[model samples]
Target: MQEILVLYYSHRGSVRALAEMIAQGIDSVPGAAARLRTVPRISAVCEATEPDIPSTGAPYAETQDLEECIGLALGSPTRFGNMAAPMKYFLDNTAGPWLSGALAGKPACVFTSTASQHGGQESTLLSMMTPLLHHGMLLVGLPFSEPDLTRTRSGGSPYGATHWAGKDDNIQLTDEEKRLATALGKRLAETALKLHAR
Candidate 1:
């Protein structure tokens, strides 16, 4: 099976929900598999403060995951229109892959969740793309051709996928949000398969 990494840092389960939907889409492709991984929470006091393994949800991501996956789906919650610190901290430490071009030519997608409709979802998604661009990865994003992208009232975007979690972060994903996320993943997996064919 070809493994596509679904790497994310979800603060209040909203991003994690999106990641699961994306993984579902990836798993729908025959010969494609979703490899779910997550990074540890950052600590202010010291480095390597988080345990090597998390207590729940996906395991902590390793640089090796980036090297091994055929494609990548990156997701994180928005923090002041940027990716959360933990995710950024993890990306900042990817010098090994950056130097070796381990992710070069691989297909990638981005996703984000926000506390409100205007809570910097697009900016967060764009920010996540910066490093992948530097790594020479091929960005795969949703298109307006997806009906949901044109009509979704909640969290769907051409840049990738998004969710509006509301002020309390209690809102469940709307159907449109779910479908678009799945579409993004399916699109990404198909692209990875085509590239891997070469």
Candidate 2:
């Protein structure tokens, strides 16, 4: 099966929910599967360390995951109009893969969750795209043709998928949000398959 890495850092479970939805879409495609992985949280104290294995949720991602996957779906919660630090830290450590061009020509999509509707979801998605672009990955985004993109009352975008988790981060994803995210994932997987065929 062709594997698409669903890599994300979800603090309050909202982004995780979106990740799973995207994975579902990826898995819906024949011959494509989702590899769910996450990065460890960064510590402010220099001496603090995280366990090698997380206590819950997906395992910590490795560089090998990037090497192994045919496509990528990157997600993170918004942190002041940018990706969260852990996800950024993980990408910062990807110089090895970048220098080797391991992700070149591979398809990629990005997703984000925000505390408020204006909490910088698009900027966060755009921020995540920078590293993927640097690694030469092809970007896949939801198009206007997706009906949900035109009508989402909560979270969806042409740049990628997004969720408005509210100030308390307790809001469930709207039906439109779910549909658009799934569409984005399907598009990424299909794009990867086509690129591999070339």
Candidate 3:
């Protein structure tokens, strides 16, 4: 089966919740599966290090995860209109994969959760796409065809799936947000499967 990497960084757990929904979407594809991974928190001190494995949630992501997956779904909480430091830090280390074209031609999608409606959900999603683009992965966004994109008042975007977690970071994923995230995962996996079949 083809694996779609569901990679994310979630400090408040909102983005991780979104990642799980996306993974469900990926797993729904008949011949595809989800490889869930998360990055370690970045210590402000340069020399500090995280344990080799996290205490809970998905394991820390490795460079091999990028090369092995047929598709990718990247997620993060909005960090001042950008991806969180840990996710960015992990992507920054993929130079070897970039040099080898290990991720070239793979289908990819992005997702994020922001603290408020006007928070940088779309920008964070767009920023997450940069590294995937650099790696030559095909970008996939939630199209207008997904009815939720037209009806969602909370957090669905054509750029990708997103959620508004509120100020306390307590808002749960709405049904629409969940549906769109799953759709993105399915779309990415289906696209990757077709591309690999060729």
TM per model?
0.97, 0.98, 0.97
Off by over 4 Å in 1: none
- C-alpha positional error of residue 103 in candidate 3 after TM-score superposition, expressed in Å: 0.6
Candidate 3, clashing residue pairs?
none
Off by over 4 Å in 2: none
Show model 3 residue runs off by greater than 4 Å. none
Q: Residue by residue across 33-90, what tens digits does model 2's lDDT show? A: 9999999989999998889999998999999999999999999999999999999999
- lDDT, candidate 3, 1-198, per-residue tens: 888899999898988988998999889999999999999999899899889999999998899998888889999998899999988988999999999999999899999999889988888989999889999999999899999998988899998999998887874899999999899988988898999899
RMSD to truth, every model: 1.2, 0.8, 1.0
Give the TM-score comparing model 1 with the true structure, all chains together: 0.97
Q: Judged by TM-score relative to the true structure, which candidate is superior, 1 or 2?
A: 2
Residues 151-180, model 1: lDDT tens digits = 888899899999999898964899999999
Looking at model 1, the pairs that clash are none
Against the true structure, candidate 2 has what lDDT? 0.94
